[model samples]
Target: MLGAPGPSPAEEPPGGGAASALSGLTTRGRSFLAAGFAAAVCSYVLGQADLLRVGLLLAVLPLVCVAVLRRTRYRVAGSRRLAPARVPAASETRVHLRVDNVSRMPTGLLMLQDRVPYVLGPRPRFVLDRVEPGGRREVSYRVRSDLRGRYPLGPLQLRLTDPFGMCELTRAFSSHDTLTVVPRVEPLPPVRLSGEATGYGEGRQRSPAHAGDDDVIPRGYRHGDDLRRIHWRSTARYGELMVRREEQPQKALCTVLLDTRRSAYRGAGPDSAFEWAVSAAASVSAHMLERGFQVRLLTDTGSSVPGPDGGGGLSGGGFDGAASLDTAGLLLDTLAVVDHSAEPGLSRAYDVLRGGQEGLLVGVFGELDAEQTGVVARMRHRSGAAVAFVLDPAAWSREGPADAGESEGGLRLLRENGWTVVPVAAGASLPELWRAAGDHRAAAGAPRGGAAAGHDHERA
Candidate 1:
């Protein structure tokens, strides 16, 4: 069989070597030994030499097989590879395993089994015939999970059996590999994020300090400095050949905050409000990053992506030189294993946001009490454009009807604080909600900026 059933727990050997080989005897081998002993006893009682000789041969054959198999030195190695090691939740990823036999002698029957988490699926097993010296055999299987998290796949177990099926030994490779099942990232529609235009957008205005004829900042001239670029005023002020510095446009900044306090959300499994918030955070982060925005992800505990300055929050140049795909992968990988916090409130996230300059803030929140509401409301002032997606407690859980009033009250408080609020319920369409947020910003007379129009024209 190509993919044989795994060994039963009772059939597994406890250890390797001669003792284990003897303990690994098959039913046939044990029956032969038992029958041989009985025959020998009957022959001795009847004084029959011929019967004794046949019994001895039968008994010794199984012993010889065990001794030979135990003495056989088989050097084998195993390696595992996960194609697309990082995958979105509810998606399949293939895992390939290779077994190499380095011993000079041809190997016996090989049974290969890989350990896998129950959530991902059952462990996969395969059977292969003899492999010649320096030969390798490869096998692959698919695994998937509905929930998002990190799972390990590895420590391949190989069962080597004697040609006669008289004995077997199990050996396991020590190395392991990890598979990251990230949250499903939904593609969001373009919407104007209300924020000060400090990036390379149509609405962006040069700083007043750099507006006039002396817009350039002068620096000490370097060896390759162009003489025409030298600033006369700076040269006259004790500066040796000061040349004007070339300035580069800055990228827009976006902060995505996710509420992870266990008490803030309801239900469980993949459909929980908490999970929805996580997915939303991932989608928003990816969307902003694709638009050439320096995006930072914050949770109730703290910042997930460290800034250029090595702090918990992102600095202006945090994402310098990073490709959008790489940053998106980093963000998604972080969000993949994010779980609810036992501690209450969003104080850590608030502190992280406070440390940064005014920018665009997108928050995905669950049920918030008056204290948490006030905390989040105060955060709006730090961002030029602030948008929040609040989950309806009642929709998240049938037992959470009492929290409906709290959710309504929080939304009202946020809207009064000049935040564009979108109420999210179970099964709500995120794309539609995103468009509604854009409409709300438009109705509020927020300027038409680059983020709202998409980055197509800007890229061109």
Candidate 2:
């Protein structure tokens, strides 16, 4: 996975600008003209013919070299990388650049006109004084981003010129570096959640039904276990019976799935309901990642990827894409590039995930389909999977009729059927939504969190 993303300074489309800066250099040229005119005027005013001729030669000679030097002299190249691809809100990141001189002639006065992504605004630009022939240098810049999202670093344009400003060359460089900023995760205070979802997981062997789920490791045997868990061959060899006990279900592997079927937008207003759905997914995933859960993301509006294991979990460690601060960035980056599918529903993906309910899954969708609802119902009956919905009230605004698109009622329907419903208002923060969902469980005497719980409650 660490095969450095894209080309470095050594590779990429060779700098292809044909004197764009020189051709459009009205100001710099004007300065040159003004200086020459002053020299000529001064020479004439002082009756010095020699001085006038020298100024004319000085200005015109460099002007001619400008066009020619742009196509030759030194071969300049550049590239950039954002180390620790993922960053926290209100944090800092390093942007690295690799500059190389591909030609024999040493390159000097390299002015880089990098087209940085609008997000990382270039208040202060990049400047490379000199790069020796056959030598390369890596330069770094720091950016402080306040917003959370995935941003493209860019196709940087290397603008080079000689000391006299006579000859100039322009080349474009590309970097696969992308910055992903994730929302701050506030840890849940000591609390507990009610129901089998939270407490039932403690000290229990892998449930027979969930044994097939991926990521569930098997521990060695113990006495008084079911006959099915006994290892017969080992008993014959070692003269002692051994059985396999299921390891405790890991708290890391959490997946968030968002519903993006177009039909869910029936009654929305200014902001499309789809955007709210994405926010919900981002919020929940960010929260879980902060809590040390191995987090993965899935959204119907964009591409759906099951986040990798151990990498993004709340275990407090580095991630090689699977579990890292950039995990959220990659998720949102994929989200940014992915468009909503026109498919009728999410039945197929839900069906596939039903039997493999290994990690925690949070499904968010704007509208509810029968097939999707049915799958959720089944997963609940068998695996005790936690289900939460981010339903939009706007779907009823311009819906077929005022009563036709009511969301609260549909949300209620899911709750009645035993699915957890988090009534998320539009424009709400993801952490806020989780708090709301958690508050309800607390009110009903459900285990809200684990900071404070009894011996049995500590399992949460």
Candidate 3:
């Protein structure tokens, strides 16, 4: 049951409105008083005892409920918990709420509700019959959305209603939390690429020679130095404890380029082609990170996934260089709040890749025109291995022809320039579609083309 507004000491006036508007008497509360006054006047003038008694009862009934409610001071507390703190777009997440009544006296019928982001769904509400002093109650609800973003979960609203339904009071709690809805990512099929890490690490072949004249010199052993790295020859020569310092391995980096320019994609909202491109980028990042590749995520407008602490982002074309599984969550968290920019093209990404060291380049893009296709072709030459997944905006538009051939033209151009191009459709199975990409670079031979080439001309 909803209630009349009441003062909220715990909250500010919503939208900077005046405080008086926050609380007011209900229509029912006013009507009961008006009826009582009229009846009392008539009974007194007509000298009718029964009518007088009825008038008194009507006047006093609401007062009694109001007085009881006013004497009961309800001090309530609440905490909200979002399960699976991180989730993918269009997936279900559960919210758990635990409320405690810390008042000295028991609470009357209390109504509870929580505010949420519009995209996540409607505000959830519940009725608590009563809670004894120092007692608690728990409630849970589910939220599902097709949008990817970080949203705040609450500031719980509580209401107190009289048993007679004549009086009502409402209050709002000021506690809030965040929910991160990241882009949906799926597992991709196994694929092979050709590249050698240039940074540092002992690869399949061993090199006994030191890197350079400035290589790390043996010194006194440190607390954390491994005993296995102790150089007995250096220790004997120096007449003290000495250990050889190992060099960090140079791992090959895989750069995931996401096209977030507003002009590059078609449609809008959950089913937009831009959203598909983001999901593809997220999946590819996860796949590469799992394979122990240092990953870098980049977008058109220089936006990147900031670390959890909001520092140390993949800015300035530097790969994160951490190949652990834990690094995937950090990348996904950044993608959750990514929004499209007004930039016209992918020129920024192209420029950054052109000057960076050669490794692997993975491009998740939208429909490409002639000029954009050339930009991609030029960028492909700077990398040891290049793969591009292009989203066909025409396939996703209801008014456009599904068999539009621009995507095929773009794909052919990319293929001719040594880039393995894969065309993607909306709602297509990512695993099956990725597995159909037939381009592979041999260990010794040139980039070879495989036979999974039907979508080049056929409508998605």
Candidate 4:
């Protein structure tokens, strides 16, 4: 998000009056004024004209500087630009600030500071000696965050001080810029994803000449119908113009589901099991999109990315050609700020999966109870191929590893349902697990279930 225009430095003070001007006096300036007053009192008691003159000069100088600074109309504008506005966690991004002195008068020493979140690092500060009339100055700083989220930078604070350092006034611009720190995406080796290429264009043949009359599907002729496509036999029988319906190619679909229930995972911070799942979801989404598969990022609540139909699902309309990159970006951006949901179960995810067409399902989940396991078992029926990365409770549990027997039982149930299951432990290698999934699919062959149970001991 970009910042909006704000009040100018000179006009920022309330009513631009004397009270505001007096409040700008620095401690040193106030001290001088006090000393000057005391000296004037002593000089009057002793009737010394030289002492009186010196006291008067000391008292008036600071006041004079304040009055001059207050009357000086300063017109300046500030703009902040972020390079690579969206960055991966623990990565650095540069922020460029441009300050334009639009006023006719030369500005005095200026101190600039930009506000930033503590996680991103300390506030950036810069000092400029002066900006000649109608001059501009640019400065930049770098910020990095280990955590992922959106952070606001700005309301750029400017401190204006007199040349003599007698007074200092602080003003802040109203505009603010936003920086999105997204989850880190790991590069995965290209392994054949099972069932991802099962759609019409990839696996099925489209032929019109080989089809009999019954196999030829036709629709009413429209204004732009090609004359060559007219089916004379269907037209003659129906007594109306009919055109052969073209077989539209369908892109393979991939849905990346992330378990975000607060009770599902253990630990906290960047190393938490939940964070790991988020990163894995982002990686898989990008990988599938690059492979030209129509991808959807679904959370425990609902779809994370909206489709072309303005619904909460990915449409098949723009998954091909140049729109793939844009889709990948939108998916990553959504995952960057995804948070844990309070929902206690995976029912919502189940419904979303049930409503969509069967394709490839990739899930990153935490510990699952019997009810949750049952729900997931039902979900497998809706996908051509399903793979699940279930986090090991023992790896992230604060009390220690969970019961191994319970974990094994859940994995067995998913395997029985034809799902390729991979157990994720602390510090697990995502790419390695990804490759293992492909290996499991190849070993399983025609049927994708039961065979994966032999690999249950394998952990990544």
Q: What range of 10 consecutive residues in model 1 has the weakest lDDT sum? A: 1-10
Reference-based TM-score of each model: 0.86, 0.60, 0.78, 0.87
CA-only RMSD, every prediction:
7.2, 9.1, 8.0, 6.4
lDDT (10s digit) by residue, model 4, range 1-460: 1112454332264665688778889988898888889889989999998888888888988899898876777777888999989999999999999988887888998898999999998999999879998788999999999899999997788788899988887777877789999999999887765676543222221112221222346878989879998989999989999988776545567778899998898778988898899999998887776675777778888654656211233333334444666676687778888998998999998998887777788999988998999999999998888899999655775567778888789999999998999999888999999999988877777453454655664642
- Tens-digit lDDT string for candidate 1 (1-460): 1112133111333665567777878888898788889889989999999999989988887888788876777777677789989999899999998877767888899998999999998989999899998898999999999999999886778887888887766767667789999998888887765563433323331122222233346878889778998888989996578888665545566778888888887789888778888989998887776665667788888755745311233323334434556677778888998888986898888887777666678899887789999999999877777889988755777664555566678889999998999988677878889889988987766443545666667777
> lDDT tens digits, residues 1-460, model 2?
0012244342223444544534534455647766777888889999999989977975675576665555455656566677767775457888877777776877767666545566666634677787777788777778766555677676666665656665555555545456776544444342232322235332121122232332334334555568897667766666776665555443435557767677766533224456556555666666655554555565543334543332322231122333455665556565543445686776655654554445555677666655555555554443234558656545434343224445446666667665667765555565556666666655544443443456556575
**lDDT values, one for every candidate:** 0.76, 0.56, 0.70, 0.79
Q: Which numbered prediction scores highest in lDDT against the true structure?
A: 4
Candidate 1 has a TM-score of 0.86
Give me the runs in candidate 4 sitting further than 4 Å from their true place. Answer: 1-16, 198-227, 238-241, 307-322, 446-460
The C-alpha local distance difference test score for the whole of candidate 1 amounts to 0.76
lDDT of 1 at 89: 89
Clashes of 2: 25
Which stretches of candidate 1 lie above 4 Å from their native place?
1-17, 196-217, 308-322, 400-405, 446-460
Which model is ahead, 2 or 3, in terms of lDDT?
3
- What order do candidates take by lDDT, descending? 4, 1, 3, 2
lDDT of 3: 0.70
- Residues 257-366 of candidate 3: C-alpha lDDT, one tens digit per residue: 89887777778887778877888888988876666566778888755444321123232212334424446777888788787888887788887777665667788887
